[model samples]
Target: SGFLGFVALNSEFPQVNPAGSVLLPLLTGLFGAPVLLISAFSNSSNIPRQERRLAFPSVFAALKGSIAGFFVSIFPGISSGVATVVSSIGERSDRGYIVTMSSANTANAILCFFMLIAAGRTRSGASDALKSLNLVPSFQEIAILSIFSGIVAFLLTIFFGLLIAEKIEKIDGRKLSLSVLVFLTAIVLLLTGLQGLAILLSAIPIGLSTHFLGVRRINCMGCLMVPVMIWYTG
Candidate 1:
């Protein structure tokens, strides 16, 4: 749906203005409707289940995550979403998974700055936006901002972690999922217009297959991966 939305915005095939608003309804219809149905029809499992025993994140986990994140930072078009799936291959524990996810996301952003300095190129939309605004900073400046952002984020996390965590824990899973669907729907509709919605609706089933087949959503990366392979190989 998202890729299709991009196409509708860029291409003149449909003879519509290039706008992201078209993706709104397509996505909302495809994904939102299904989740909404599931949320409404499915009964919550009230029975208590045995908890799976797991260890907290350890030094090895952090190191592994840091390394993986560092590697992902260098790969163009391999977004954090794809990195998460790829990194999950060797990960053993939930804590480890979280560590990888957190590190990948943060490292990707931090590396984008370094990417500007090293490759003299911007690979991310944020970097492009920064370039467009003519606000590109030096490596030293980036380092300082990184430290400041990390400190602030860490402090904020410490301050609000428990309260926010508790509140999130209290939210029903189905309700939360439904809310996400609703939010996506609203965002799609409000931003893309009717055509974007059409594309989104078409893409929903493809996205849902990941869940039904018990596979990682990493395959979604095929959107870029296939074209990339062709671009390089061709």
Candidate 2:
């Protein structure tokens, strides 16, 4: 019923316009702001000193994630979060989920480029932009670019992970979360103005209900899923 109501509510509003898409505010409210608010107010808000050691995840987990991402990219109405969940099936370790999700994200991005070129389908915003600009590259070119970008991104991730681990203990987690919440609000206001602000404020409570009700966070995806389902099936 909650999901249905959320879907109904979103259906009543125009999700996009020349100004901006409601996605920026809706996603921020559902995923970003709620987490920040929870972290800001939680008694255990202080972040622990993370270990600086690097470890390789299971090859099987990565393979599963890659497969899931490939399948997700071939279809519309499926999201990376859903693919991550699918990839984590039977995984018991936290490290497995971590690696699997990361790999899924990587594979999804790379495959979206391929999907854009091969099927003219825009699986991501970047692909949509490329399609709009008529900038789709050849298969060979995209593959080479994907490989190069992946290597660079992997190196950057390690560097930033280690750097953040070194300085994380000194950062105030609550204050950081609150700062992010403020920044997110400002961005929504700047991009979407008062109407977007109103949507953000409305959506935040719904996002919070997921936490308080002990429901899966993924259920909040109804905002997108329901609307898409309606559009495709209507």
Best by lDDT: 2
* lDDT digits (tens) for residues 1-234 of candidate 1: 345434543544341333333323533453456556456557861223333443456666666556666776686646666556666678877777887778777777888878877886665556754665667899899999999999999778766764565465455667667677778766666555555556666767766676678866566555445444555687
List per-prediction Cα lDDT, in the order shown: 0.62, 0.80
- Runs in model 2 lying further than 4 Å from the true structure: 1-19, 129-141
**Model 1, runs deviating above 4 Å:** 1-56, 116-122, 128-135, 189-195
Per-candidate TM-scores read: 0.69, 0.84
Root-mean-square deviation of every model: 5.3, 3.2
Residue pairs in clash, model 2? none
Report backbone clashes per prediction: 17, 0
- Candidate 2, residues 1-234, lDDT tens digits: the string is 235334434645442344454566777787789999999999988889899898887999999999998898888756677789889989999999998998898889889999988888877756765775678899999889988988998899899999999889889999999999999898788766777777788788989999999987778777766766776787
Cα-based lDDT at residue 18, candidate 1:
33
